[model samples]
Target: MSNIIIGTAGHIDHGKTALIKALNGFEGDSTNEEKQRGITIDLSFSNLTKGQQNIAFIDVPGHEKLVKNMIAGAFGFDYVMIVVSAAEGIKPQTVEHLEIINLLGLKEIIVVITKKDLVTLEQLEEKKEQLLMFLDTFDFEIKFIHEVSIYEKESIEKLKNSLFSINNSIKQEENFFRYYVDRVFSPKGIGTVVTGTILGKKIELNEKIFICDSQMESKIKNIQVHNINALEANISNRAALNLQGVNINQIKRGDLITKKGHIRGFDGIDISFKCLKDKKLHHNQTYTLFIGAKKVEVKVLLFDCITTLETGYATLKADEKLYCIFGEKIILRNANDTICGGKVLNPIIDPMKKNQKRRLLEALDNSDFTAAYKELLDAHKKGLGIISSTQRFALSHERAIEFANELENVFVDVKELVIYPMETKDFIKDFIKIIYTKNTYALLSNASINLRLKWASTAFIQSALDELVNEDFLTRDVSLYKNSNIKEDFTKELETVFLHRLKQEDITPTAPYNIYDDLDIDRKLGDDILKSLTAKKQVIRLQHNLFIHFESLNKIVKEMKNIIKEDGFIDISNFKTRFDLSRKYLITYLDYLDNYSNIKKVENRRVFV
Candidate 1:
């Protein structure tokens, strides 16, 4: 089935709710306050399904004070229905609603002139002409204009059929799913439930979702579309999801629901904006930013201008993190007055110079991702990660790789999703050359080198190591690489040196890996040399990573026996009384006493046989 969200926009008492009641028999004003005031206050949701088409209606309040509520619903609109009363023609709230929707990029418009019974035929035609001329001033394509009254059932049915006749609005099949919570409540017998329009992608019945604001994960316990149970909900469908693990108090309006790791929240984001009418956006001034049913107070910082700008690129810095994606629309308002509308250009904050940021924002605004990639590569000379392209540029992994391939003198690691300027390889090559020059006995591997250069991937390090091998500067033995100049095997020399070093420490010896570093030998080679010494009886393996020279072990055993002879029984406490040693050495020494059958164990103490 196809789904579309159609939102109503107009002045107060323009019959937007009455028309919905006439068409689908849904009374939008469900609250006691709304019933008493006789006006729509908050957003009301209802749907009409005919055949295979489902059209969800979002009835927004037309009161000027409720414009914020209107904006919250406008973000999910696929098409907007502009309701203008025949008697009132066009009012202040009507013009403001049109301007806001136009700023939000709503192109397809359905003009509904209601209260037709209140006006004569001649007056109706004049009003229709006036509405057309007024709408033509903006950039919306007028799809249809209908005259209807709540008393006329025939006109209501005709309008409903016309709505279904229109082609289904196109919804981009994005890879990630997200929905902003407009209403959260826990029904009696049910768990926490949130209602909003599904966007970006479809959601399944039992899918796990992350609440961005609360930083928690919840499962979909149930799925409801327009009060009917469903197995799945598609993009643009008004859905109510019963969440399993969270309470209703934990969620509020504007909390984002999406798959984990698909989004990154930022306190600052870049955008290209234009103020409505003659309004000017001042730099360093705070404004309410509305996007995806969420509003945050932010200070605007113009990129190219100093004080104020009527239209241009700027950054919105909020006290709290804003989770948004590329090309998402945003509205800036001062109190209740709408200022400008913009599209999110850069949702991820990049640590770049002001000039570089301006250039990147320009490239993004023009949809030139190649320039943006180059700008990022220039700043991230070490290596740029392509994995963030999904949230940063709205490009998939394959598409990001395709863009990387188009760049000149760049190395693209598709497996690791990192892009580096070819010149970065020289740094790795130079660093490796110094290591070998300083110590001809040094043996290195890709994994060992990555320990020093954590930012460089193993694959990248291997590429540099390969270049060294080609240049005859290094030779590889399976996975270990060593200086090619030293051809003869130095295994015996390394074993003698390490065994002596272990004997010097006597009881407390450094870890094998650390000893390998001090002697400028590879870790694997050091392990091999220690094993050879152990086989020759010159070294004793004490623990998993500990090795002691034979002389040191024999001397420690004699000292431990003296302690037992002096104290009648030797335990950790008595041993420490004679020799101040760490727990590792004391425990290992006590356990090694078992090698002599002459010593008898009595619980935690050892005594003579």
Candidate 2:
């Protein structure tokens, strides 16, 4: 069975703690400070069992100065019981606590009028009327209202029955186990112990848990639910866990203990904010944000025009990083007043520019993940957009491929997916435009393409290029690539000029730079022309800055093979004499032959393979 959490809210000395004791038949306050001061300073927990249902009561401090403690204690409450004294009626703290409860979005409230024995029947009737008027100003609906005097045993029994009736109607959540650390201490013989109300799934003994937003890991040594030894603790129940592999000093209030990889920490977050009253919120104003058991200082940046009680988008930049998930409700407070509260839309880095903010808002407004994914992709259309597997909107590799398949003609790689709003065919068309505009023959090398498109990974580029080649939009020849429709009208002219220069040299090919100067073409264009000829098998690039006509190289190979066949091997001097070539060209040709398996270089001689 799921546990029901009920929190008490009201002024100090108003019998909030006394009424708790009267209902459960035991004192909720276990500290000497609370007894000496005659008030609750921090949160105190107690469990009341009626039949099969168990209700957990969190008694929060009612002093105005301890309002932060009050907010912390009311983090995960399912119901709130407002304690108002019949003699005092409505006090300042009573209104403040009601405002906080409304801001927290808690809908169920049970007003308990305490100190009833101290007032006359007429006065009690008047007090009830005034409390009703006070509650009418808020949005929450009251579940039940009852008069209770701790001295009266019947009134206490009536309140317990009312609690049991409400427990049956509260809905339970089935989210993953998330327990906020409200108290961390070391008990003798137990090592480190953490106590908090479990807000999510059941936690079992020996379960590995991570301290949220931190790199600390601990295992549950034992579990205790409502002071009973248990193997597992159900959701909404108060639990004390004996933790192993962590020290008591390593954690504190507001740190979360949850299953690893279930949530991530973010420094900035976007929220849907609304003020409770006609209060103007300024940009860059610092406020305290209360979510779960954590309180973080955040600076507000409003996206829409500022107005009173208006709901709009805003970004909250925390002074320190905090861990939260989407749809988590947050309460914002100034130093003195509770201003507004809202639900988290996204938790991520800040959008630094107005355009990025617009894109983010548009993406968040979409109801489906696919639309949001597309908007994010459009925002980064100028380059590759990266979304890691750990992000909230990240799809699995299989799901990403499904999205790609759903969208026609869109290329996506599982290892490094790239999403674009335009079709992959259009992307190739644009890439062809770049290649055609830069070179006369509409050709580009892989290295050149990588330099122009630096944002894309090599894997993504290779995948896209292969898709374009399969689609007959481009052609690849060894290391050089070109558009399939490119005419290459100047290819023959460039090839004729290159071969003429090679022939002009005596027994050696001319260096590429000398040819570039002789032809009066740019070095890059010259190199592209030479690489194009080499790709077509019309020329052989023997080494760096060396080229030979393919036909002439083949004739030399035939003569060297015949000489090796007759003599078994040919030394460097003999090879140079046979070809009438210089030492540089002869050595380069021999290495090229060795590389192609046409000849084997054994020691200082070349042998026919």
Candidate 3:
């Protein structure tokens, strides 16, 4: 079945809720406060199904003070039903709602002139002409202008048929699933259940979802679409998810649910904004930001100037982390008045200079992703990851790679999703060359070198190694790269170097892995060398990581015996008093005394046997 969300917008007491009830036979104003007040207070949800077509209705409150609640439901709308009363014609809230829908880029408009029975035939016709003229000023496809009175059943059926005839569903073709929570509640038996429209992709039962605000993970214990049990829900389907591993207090309206690692939150985001008619957005001014059902107070900082402007680039500095995607629509308001609307350009915060940020935002505003990538690559010289392309640039991985391939003087690691400036390759080459120059017996591989340069991918490190091999600076022996100047006896030379280095350090020797790193050799080869030395008794192994030359062990044993003779007993404290070494060395040396035929163990102390 195809699903579409249609929201109602108009002034208060315009029959928005009654029209919904008449069409779907579902009561939208279910709460006591709403029933007593005879108005829609919060967002109410209902749906009407015809064959395989399911049209969900999000009945938003039309009161001026409830505009925030209206915006929360508007983000999920594919089409809007403008409810206008025939007696009053167009009102202030109607104009504001139309402007907001236009700013949100909603193109489909279905104007429903309600209460036609209350107005005379000529008066209703005159109101229809006025609404048609006003709607022409905005960009919208007037699907139809239908006059309806809830008292008449034929009018509601005609409107319902017109809606069911919509064959096209505006669904986002994204690979990840995202749902914005609009309503949250806990039942007596069931756990926390949240209702919202499925976006981006489909979500299946038993799938794990991540809550953005609480940073918690929950599983879908059950799924319901329009109050019908289902195993999965697709884009545009109004779903209620019974979640496990989270409390009702943890989730609320405006929280986001998505898969792990699909989104990265930012405390600030960049956008290209245009103010509403006759309104100016000032720099460094705080406003209420609404996106994906979430509303936050944000301070707007215009990129071009410190003064007020009608349209430009800006950054919204928010107090809380915002989980948003590129190209997502945002509504800005000051107090209760809708000020401006914007589209997110950069959802990921770039740590850069202000001027660079401006250039990047300027390029992004123009949809010049290549220039924006270049600007970001300048600051992320180590490498820039394209895995975040979906959230950062609204481009898929393949599309991002296509743009990356168009750039010059950059190395694109397609498999790793990393893009490095060409100069970074030279930086790696220079650093590796210094390592080989300092240690002629250095033997390394891409994996070993990756440990030293953790920021660079193994593919990037291999590229640098291959470049060195072309220049005859290094020779490849399978996966290992050896200095070209090294002799065939390099293995023997490495073993001798290790032994001599151990003797030089005497009683305090570095771990075998550190020795290998300092000498710029493969860890496996270092292990083999240490094994050969220990097999011949040329070195002594006191602890797992402690290895010492035989002569150094003998000398330490002699010094320990002298301490035992003077103190009549020697333990870690007395051994440290003489050698002034760390506890690791002191304990190892004192334990070695037990191997002596003349010594015996005395609890925590060592004495003559």
- Computed on alpha carbons, the lDDT of every model, listed in order, comes to 0.91, 0.75, 0.91
RMSD of 3: 1.6
Candidate 2 residues lying further than 4 Å off, grouped into runs, are 168-175, 304-311, 350-352, 355-359, 362-374, 380-470, 474-609
Model 2, residue pairs in steric clash: none
Report backbone clashes per prediction.
Answer: 0, 0, 0
In candidate 3, what are the lDDT values of residues 516-568, reduced to their tens digit?
99999988778788999999999988888989999999998988888888989
**What TM-score does each of the candidates earn?**
0.95, 0.68, 0.97
CA shift of 3, model 2, Å: 1.7
Instruction: Give the alpha carbon lDDT tens digit for every residue of 83-105 in model 2.
Output: 99999999988888888878777
Off by over 4 Å in 3: 596-598
Question: Which lDDT tens digits does candidate 1 get at residues 1-609?
Answer: 888889999999999999999989999999999999999999999999998999999999999999999999998899999999999999999999999999999999899999999999999999999999999899898878899998998988889988998758655667788899999898899989999999878899999999998899999999999999999999999999999989889999998999998888999999999998889999999999999899889999998787999999999999998998888899999988999999999999989998899889999999899999988988898899998888888887788899999999888999999998888999999999998899878887788888789999888889999999999999998988888998888777777788789989888888898997777676777888888888999989989988888888898899999998888989999899888999899999999998898998889999999
In terms of lDDT, the poorest run of 10 residues in model 2 is 383-392
- Whose lDDT is higher: candidate 1's or candidate 2's? 1
Residue 257 deviation, candidate 2, in Å? 2.5
Error of 3 at 117 (Å): 1.1
